[model samples]
Structures are given as structure tokens and as C-alpha cells.
Target: MGRDAPAAPRMAAPAAAHAAPAVGDADRRRARDIHVAIVGGGGTGAAILHDLTQRGLRCTLFERGELTSGTTGRHHGQLHSGARYAVGDTDIARECMEEVTILRRIAAESIEMNYGLFIALDDDDVDYTAAFERACSESGIPNRRLSTTDALRHEPGMNPNARHAVMVPDGTIDAYRLPLQFLATARAGGATIRTFCEVTGIDSSDGRVSGLTVRDYRSGRDERIAADVVINAAGPWAGSVAALAGVGLPITPAPGTMVAVKGRLCNMVVSHLHPPGDGDIIVPQRNLSIVGSTQWKVDDPDAIRTPPDDILRLLDRARELVPAFAGAEFHAAWTAVRPLSGRTDAGGRELSRNFQVIAHASDGAAGLFSVTGGKATVLRAMGEAVADDVCRFTSLAIAGRTADTPLLAHREFFRRQERVHEPV
Candidate 1:
């Protein structure tokens, strides 16, 4: 996690002549008129909205709060290359690899291309390390073994007990910049985004979704927006969103707590090549060191706070990797809920990381869909999958061109505009 800078300048509202067209399929001669409502403005939802708008679909994004005010904004910014799950979760590893490469290419402005290291602190785990390296190699991820001396030289703050390290292509990402950049590009491509709008109800007749009722939190005004389709990409709140439509979705909310320190303890991402455990990874961001995390199932995503005991446990484990991190000033802490789907009795950690696209048409309801599960690094891939489903149901012939298109081009126009209005 990084320190929160002053909020970016707000863009001017669309002109009256540029308002979204009225709701009518025939009147929607241009893609800007075929309205699609997306609930939740987190990374997954934002990525989906970007992809949809880029493919010429009119999109409106609704968030109950600011963009990325959910799990997408509350995470250790390490961009995994799928190596972390190679030991037991090969499926997640594969997905991570594909999306990691794609995001590095498309969203260059939001990524830091630093490599990651997984260190083994004891000789007893050398065999496990070797097996893990082999698994990564077989899974198409490149892993190189680093000697203890070499590892210590690279990261002087590393624990002297660290005996071996494996280097992989992992990097840190700006979670804040990632979604904001997506929103900027989506809006540029003609998407309408309304923050602080909370979706209250789903209006359906004849078993088909017709529109959505939303309340502007700031003005306390209620309004309804007609839409051809309603997508639930509310991260941990997906279940609640479905309930508004009288549908049941089995989404389990799992919360993880992370701590941010005042400075970088290591120049690259460092992790323990072991099962899910507390403080197994340390990620370096702009001016802070992010050490996390502890996973526990929760009932509400909004109730996120870091427990003191968990914070102590994290510091203890982190010191084993970097001894200099022992007394680093605690800057801040936060929690994010991971949306898991499966039988509640099956356990949240056991649930697959792969995402699922649910269409209500098969269950007697039409024009509604729900996307759940998966990590932030793989959001673009998930967006592609959901967009394909939406196009099939809408009878739209738009092709999925987002995979090859760069999301946003660096332009001098925004820089010049910012300079003109910058506060002294």
C-alpha cells in the first residue's frame, strides 16, 4: 500500500448535448445509446466497463462510493506471475500468467516492472523449493535459483538466515492508478460513470430485468435508469446485489488484513513459497512497504479492520524475511474481502480462484448476469469472458478487440489542462 496523495482533479461534466441518449434499442443507432448498467466500481467492474465501452457498447458504472473503495483498493500491490500458486493451485497460476502479461502490455502506466523473490530460510525446505521451482517451470513461468550470498547482496535487509531464493517475474502495481486509468479510458471511449450512486432495487416484469432504481447518496435523490442489461460485479457485495432481484448467489466473503509501513524495506517483492499464511509477502510501493496478509472468512465486506494480534503476528513473520523491518513505523492498516463462491461448508480457501459467469436466462430470467471470484491481476481476462456472454445475449455483433488495443495513450492535452488549473 502507498500513501494517499491528494485526490486527482475532477474532470468536467459532459455537456448537455453529450448526455446519454434515451433508452430505445432502435434509437440506439450509435453504441452510446445501448445502455448497460454495471453495479460496483471496483477493479473488476471498472475493467468490464472499460472493455464494454471499448467494444462500442454504451456503459454506465454505478458505485456506492468512490472508485476502488473496495477490495480492489485495499490489497498488497504485488503483481503475481502465478508462481505463488504453483505448488498446489496450478489453475490460478495459469490464469495469473496470462493476465499478468496482458496487463503489463495494456496498462503500462499503472504497473512497476520489478521482479519478485521467494526465499527459503532453512535447509530443511530446500527439497520443497526445488519441487516448487520445477512446477513453476512446467507451468510456463521462468524461475531462477539464487544463492544465499547473491540474495543477501541484492536485498541487504533480508534475514541472514535466508539460505536460498528463487527469482520470478513478479512486480508491484498501483491499485489506485489501475482502476482510475481504466475509468479515464472508459469515459474517453464514451462510457457514463456516476459515482456515489447506490443501486437500491431491480425493476423486472415478465421475469425480465427492465431497469434499476438508484439513489444519489450526495443529494438524497432517487432515480431510475432503464437498461437492456444489468451486471453484478460488486466484488464481495455480489450476493446482496443479487438479492435485490430476488435471486440467490452463493458468494462467501473472505477478509484479509494488511499493514503499510513508512518506507521500502526491500526493492522488490519478497514472498515465502509456502501455503497461505500470515505476512508471507512484502511488497515495495512508491514510498511505503506493504507487508501482509491474514485471510479469514467474514460476513460483511464493509466491516474491515486490522486486529492488533494479527498485526503483531505479521510483524513477527516479516522480521524473519527482513530483519530491518522489525521496528518500521506502522503507517496504516486496512482489510479487503475476497469474494468466494461455493458451499459455505466447503471452506473459502478451498474455493477455486477461477471466475464464474452466471446468466439468468438459463434459469428463467433474462437480461441479467453475475460475475464472481478471481484476483485483480486476472480482471481483464474475466472482463473479456463476461463481455462475450453479454454480446451473445444482446445479439450484438461487436468483437472483443480489447485484448489487442492499448487502453489509454499518454497525451499532452491532459497535462496541459492540469497545468492550467493546478493549485499553487
Candidate 2:
């Protein structure tokens, strides 16, 4: 999940199209004639590539290392149902709910509809139940209240002293596979993907983006690629990417530590009944049960380390949710940096989890856009928002259909022989 992960393996044959007919020669020609270069190969970039290519725009994606090697690969893998953020941010909660429905339709293979439980362990947690359930309902998230006996029966492993509980449509997400599905669908639409290619410079003219100068890590060679637009979707590193274009972006790389224990102590995603906080959520990924996370601001996303204290603290918190968590063998621990939308001096808890697409025209870098913030749950919406902004900026009349379009299976990404650049 770090910057030094192994290079992505070579993919096989092109995936079969699930959205529309195979792109025609004329369509590809038109797409190639209006080039767009995306800087990042994570979920956001993958979705953007799919959207733009479907709208008949030629696009190329550049990644400094392997795809999903950064925050995307390290995600906690919780398929949020908007319940967690309902109390504080209704808009984000609703967005998560909306995207969950859409993603379940398109990327079904990458998800586990196992559902989740928010258990109240104490008087405070019990008192918060009413507000929590109300917020969820206002946000259109279905929540079913349960007695402690019923809750324990649903998840026998949870803390026996749990006073109350609520069920939400939360599930587990294959973070890596979901993005790969988007990338595979994009390839079928005739978009080019270049892994191990790092964007070194932004070529601009008359205060507008012109192209990109990239270093192909595989070949150890630098090459100049022309483009009409350049989008920075580098997640936690988006601020650095924008700096390359001489644009100042308000992005905070807030890192959180997560620890995974060996056994699947809980089958359903278990969360604290109170407001979102550190180590309050535990998600089951296959045989491993993961508890996370403690957040704090960091200047560099790459320089982060899993603090020893966070590990102990998270395990302690996990014990409160599921007492069995204390005895489960420790599996692994890691940190993931969140690309919070604002510059915060605190632990970034005050910042909204919502996303924003900033067109750098105001910063004298027209044709250059940067999208930051948002969680994996609403990645498609993030792409749709950014794509709409890019289209409006370029005065292109293109409508996004990613929501209604079905994506190819995740494994199909490796099965597709598409336009992947082979470094010479």
C-alpha cells in the first residue's frame, strides 16, 4: 500500500463491453483529436477515464507507481452506507447512500452486501441512538433499531454489555477491485492507461494547460505528451501535483492508522453508536477482522508511519465493540492518508468529508483541474462532478452516463488486451 509496491502485472485481453457498443474508428479518432491527460491511477482517476472516454474524449492516465499503490490500496475497505456521517454531515451521508446504490448495480463483484451494526456499549452510546437513527432516516439511510439480545444474536461476537443497536446497509468493498473494474471499462472504451509513468511537469501556454512531461519508470526515459486538459486526481498527493502546475490547492493529507487482527471475530461491520471517532469501526475482510483508525494531519503522505500508540489504542477500542478483539492474534497494521478538502491545523475532524473539483483557471492555470476529498463510496459521483466541470471548461457538450452504465468485472481488467503503453 506504499509508494514502493510492486509494479502492476501486465493485463491480458480487452474486457467485453458492458455499457455500450464497441467504440468505432471515427469515435476513437474524434476522441484522440481532443486529448485529456489524467494524473493519477486511483479510483477517482479510473472513474474519470471511464466517464470521459464514454463521452468520446481521448484520455491517458499517468501514475508514478503501480495503480492503487497509494491510499486506494490501503483503504479500510468499508462500503459506507452514509450512516456514519449522518449526524454531522447530512449531505455527505446522502451522497454516500446514493452512490452505494449505483455502485451495487455496476460493480457488484467488488462488494459484499453483508450489512453492518452500530452497537451502543454505554449510557452515552445508548442516549445517542435516537439522534443517530433520526439522522440516518433524514439522509434516506434505512436503519433498524434492535434490542441488546437481538443485536448479540445478529453478531454473537460483539460486546455482550451492548445496551442498544442499529442496523445500516453498510458492507465491505474490494477497494482495489472496484477501481480496476472502472479501469477495465475505460480500456474497452479506447482509453490509454500508462502505469509506472510519473508526471514531472505541467506544460502550459497563455495561462492554460498544454501537455505534460512524464518520466516512464519502466524505461527510465522522460517523454512529453500533449493534452488539452490535465486533471490531478492524486488523492493525498494532489496538493503536490497541483504545485507542479504552479497552482495552490487546499488539500490536507490526514493520515489514520488501522490494525487488523487474524480472525474474523465479527461477520458484520461493527461501529460505535455515537458520532464517528477513532477506532470505532471494525470491518471484516475475508478471514481478517480490521479495526481502525486514529486521524491526524501530516505534511507528507509518504512520510507517515503506523504509530505504536495508535496500534494499542485501536485494539483497546476494538475490545469495547467486540470483546473477542483483545485476544485475536494481531495480523498487521498500516496507515492511510485521507485527502481532506481543506487545510486544517487540527486532526482534520472539523473538515467536511465532501469532495471538490477546483478548476485552476482562477489561479492562472486554466485547463488544469484538481479534485480532492471524498471517500471511495462516492467515487463515481466525484468523477461525474469533475467530468462535468471539465466539459464545461472546454465548452464540450457531453453528458455523463456512468451512473446508468454497467462496469465490466474487476478480473476482466487483467483479461483485456487494451491500449496499455509498453515502455520501450
Give lDDT per model, in order. 0.77, 0.87
Looking at model 2, how many pairs of residues clash?
A: 6
> In candidate 2, what are the lDDT values of residues 1-424, reduced to their tens digit?
0121132223322333334335466544554578889999999999999988877788889999999998998999999999999999988999998888888777777887788999998889888989998999999998899898998889898888888889888999998999998998888877889999999999999999999999998889999988999999999999999999998889999999999999999999999998888999999989999999899998889968789999999999999999998789999999999999989767688899999999899898999999999999999998899888987876666678788677877777787765677431
- Candidate 2: 10-residue stretch with minimal lDDT: 1-10
**Candidate 2 global CA lDDT score:** 0.87
lDDT of 1 at 181: 63
Error at 170, model 2, angstroms: 0.4
lDDT per residue, candidate 1, 1-424, as tens digits?
1222232223323232123333455434555456789999988898888778776687888999988998898868878888888777787788887777777766776777677889897665676887898888877787888887887777776776777888888888888777766666676666777778899998888888888999988788898889888999999999899889888888888888788888788887888866657799998898788888887887777867678888888878888887778879988888788887654664466777668889987554588899988888888887888888887887766666555555553342243232221111
* TM-score of structure candidate 1: 0.88
Model number with the top lDDT: 2
Query: In model 1, which range of ten residues has the least summed lDDT?
Result: 415-424
lDDT of 1 at 94: 82
User: What TM-score, computed on C-alpha atoms, does each candidate reach?
Assistant: 0.88, 0.93
- Taking all chains together, the TM-score of candidate 2 against the true structure is 0.93
